[model samples]
Target: MHKEQEKVTDKNRFKSCMMKPDEEGNIYCPQGHAFTLEQRKESVKGRYPRTIQFYRNEHCEGCPLRSQCTRSKHGRTLQRTDKLAEMQIEIRENLMTETGQELMKQRSI
Candidate 1:
């Protein structure tokens, strides 16, 4: 019973993430989908885990556009109040690390 419930929940979450905007004032997913804010609210209601991992090592390790992304010398920094903010920060920080600097150097080469 528990496993079944978990599967249902996972399915709902997957649906929510893929939601997009529709012609009405509502959100839709890419496949001509539609989801009401109420449904979205209920779906996401919980003490959800923080999805953003804001560590220096992780940030320094995998940024492709580091140089043109930040003004910080040590590395780029990021702050997020939402889920996508972390990804945005990660991309920005990648543009400002030593590795990013090297990439910049290579670009100039």
Candidate 2:
């Protein structure tokens, strides 16, 4: 993968592990604070174009995990996109199928 792609994936992995969005598109912090969708914009970060969704929370100011959670004075922030999310779901489903298992085995070679 490209360096930029790797960076994005790592950043996304970190955020997704820290905060996950539900089916209703609501993301919550580790302390159970809900993040609201701030904006949706089309962005071109790499060779591919994608739509970015920005989510933010306002309750991190006094939270004990603030320092550990985010460096932004504006509280915790997260970004995601529908395409990546859907791809993740599809990949998860693919990994369960026999063809995916075979593909994985081949990839280990």
Top candidate (TM-score):
2
Each candidate's clash count: 7, 0
TM-score of each: 0.23, 0.75
Using alpha carbons, what is the TM-score of model 2? 0.75
Quote the lDDT for 106 in model 2.
98
> What lDDT is obtained when candidate 2 is compared to the true structure?
0.76
Which residue pairs collide in model 2, if any? none
1-109 per-residue lDDT for model 1 (tens digits): 1232354342453333333234564543323333332212112337755543231212432445444333455544332234664465586578679998798789889
Residue lDDT tens for model 2, 1-109: 1222344343353355446677786888877889988899997987989999888899998998777678888988788888987887788789779998899889989
Q: How far is candidate 1 from the true structure (C-alpha RMSD, Å)?
A: 20.7
Clashing pairs in 1: 20-28, 20-29, 65-95, 66-94, 66-95, 66-96, 67-95
